[model samples]
Target: MTNSELAVKAVIDTWNQTIARFDSILDKLTDEQLENEVAPGKNRGVYILGHMVAVHDRLMPLLGFGPQSYPELDEVFLTSPDKAKATPPIATLRTQWKEVNANLAKYYAQLSADDWFGKHTAVTADDFAKEPHRNKFNVLVSRTNHLSYHFGQLILMK
Candidate 1:
């Protein structure tokens, strides 16, 4: 395989592993456990999962991927200004996580060398505003890093 293929595979593998860990974490939580907050100002399991789904759902579309397509959960909950303030049921949050992971995997599997190397327009006026155009490779790396950071938070919450 080429370097680009290896890079893509590495990212996909990381995402897959993270999803598996997420599944395991969710499986161990009972309904009541999901609602248990670790401490003051900390989120419960349901809140963490909801935040994860929201971040990914929003970023995916901006990456030229799918929409915020997990319809079973309320859009307001996923995109609410106060995401940390609300916690849906454990079962519902788990279902949404599964759906988001599946969608993400599907998106990653469809990436090609050009897809990784091509330039994409940024939807925000922040850091990327200078160029407003980023290589797909950078976008993938950034997205994975963002997810990994949040996964660390989830693990800490557990």
Candidate 2:
């Protein structure tokens, strides 16, 4: 494989592994534990999980997968503070996490090497030509780090 193709594969692989790590961390928590705060004055595990769902849901549109499935979660977890809004149940968040990640996996798997190097959501085709570094592969790299960040927070509730 070309060096570029190998790089895309590596990014995709890292993202998949990060998702699995998130699942494993979450699986160890009881439904009751999901309500516990990461620390005093911090958000609960449930809120963090919901935040992930909301963020990944946003990624769908950005990645050309489809419209976001959980726009309602934006205010609850993304915009508002953790305690500012009522959080959804763990089961609901868990299902959303799975569905969104699964669909994203499908989307990422379908991209050709060229597609990975192509412009994604906002940057125009012209702009992309001028700045090839602003490609879709960067999105995966960024959000993989994002997932790992929150996954660490989720593990703290254990």
Candidate 3:
């Protein structure tokens, strides 16, 4: 395979691993545990879950997909900190997480290697021509890192 294809595959593998770890962590938590703070007086598990959902929801536009379905998630989970007016229940966020990840997986599975390397939502085509590294693949890499960071924090809830 080409080097670009190899790199893309590696990124997808890493992202899939991260998702598995996150789900494993979530699977062990009870609803009561999900309400507990990772650290005392800090963000709760529910807040973290909602925050991730909001962040991943934003990835759609960046990846050349349509807009997010959960704009309100931005205000409660993204703009504000935890205890932000009672984030969604664990069950609800879990449902959203599964659906969002499923849709994102479907979209990513359809992209050509070239499309993976192409400019994401923000950059103009001319700009992308100049700076090709700012692409959709990098977004997935960065988001994977973001998820891993939160996964560690969430794991502390148990």
Candidate 4:
């Protein structure tokens, strides 16, 4: 494979591994446990989970897949801080998390190495021409770091 293809594979693999780590941690926690704050006066497990789901769902439209499957989550999870608005049930958030990631995986699978370098919806054509690094693949790289950051916080709950 070309260097570009290998680079894309490496990023995709890291993203998937980070996702699996979250799944493993979530699988072990109960609804009540998820309600507890990760730290004193800090965000709860449910809040983090919902936040992650909301962020990943937005990636759908950001990457040109389609509109978010759960735009309602934006108010509670994305725009607001923990407890700023009522969140959905842990069960519902869990389902949404899996569904959003699964759908995104499908879209990711469809992209070729060249496609990964294509401009995402958020960037203008003129800007993309000038700043080629702001591509779909860059979004995945940043979100992978985002996921890993929260995953570290989530681990504290266990």
Best by lDDT: 4
Candidate 1's displacement at residue 131, Å, is 4.5
In angstroms, give how far residue 101 of model 3 lies from its true place.
0.5
Per residue, candidate 1 scores C-alpha lDDT tens digits across 32-74 of 7766664566666566667777766665666678566754344
RMSD (CA, Å), each prediction: 3.9, 1.1, 1.2, 0.7
Q: 2 or 3, which is superior by lDDT?
A: 2
What is the Cα-based TM-score of model 2?
A: 0.95
TM-score of 4: 0.98
Lowest lDDT 10-mer window, candidate 4?
A: 78-87
Candidate 2 lDDT over 1-158, as tens digits, reads 99989998888888888889889989989889988898888989999999999998898888777999999999999889888887777898999999999988888888898888777897888998899888888887888889989988888887
Please write out the lDDT profile of model 4 over residues 1-158, one tens digit for every residue.
99989999999999999999999999999999999999999999999999999999999999999988999999998888999898788999999999999999999999999999999999999999999999999999999999999999999988
Give the per-residue lDDT of model 3 (tens digit) for 5-78.
88888888888788888988898999898888899798888998999999999998889888897888898998
User: Which of the predicted structures, 3 or 4, would earn the higher lDDT when compared with the native?
Assistant: 4
- Angstrom error at residue 139, model 2: 0.7
Candidate 4 CA-lDDT value: 0.95
Q: In model 3, which regions exceed 4 Å deviation? A: none
Better of 1 and 2 by TM-score: 2
Question: How far off is residue 21 in model 1, in Å?
Answer: 1.1
Error of 3 at 15 (Å): 0.8
Query: Could you estimate the TM-score for every candidate?
Result: 0.75, 0.95, 0.94, 0.98
Error of 1 at 53 (Å): 0.8
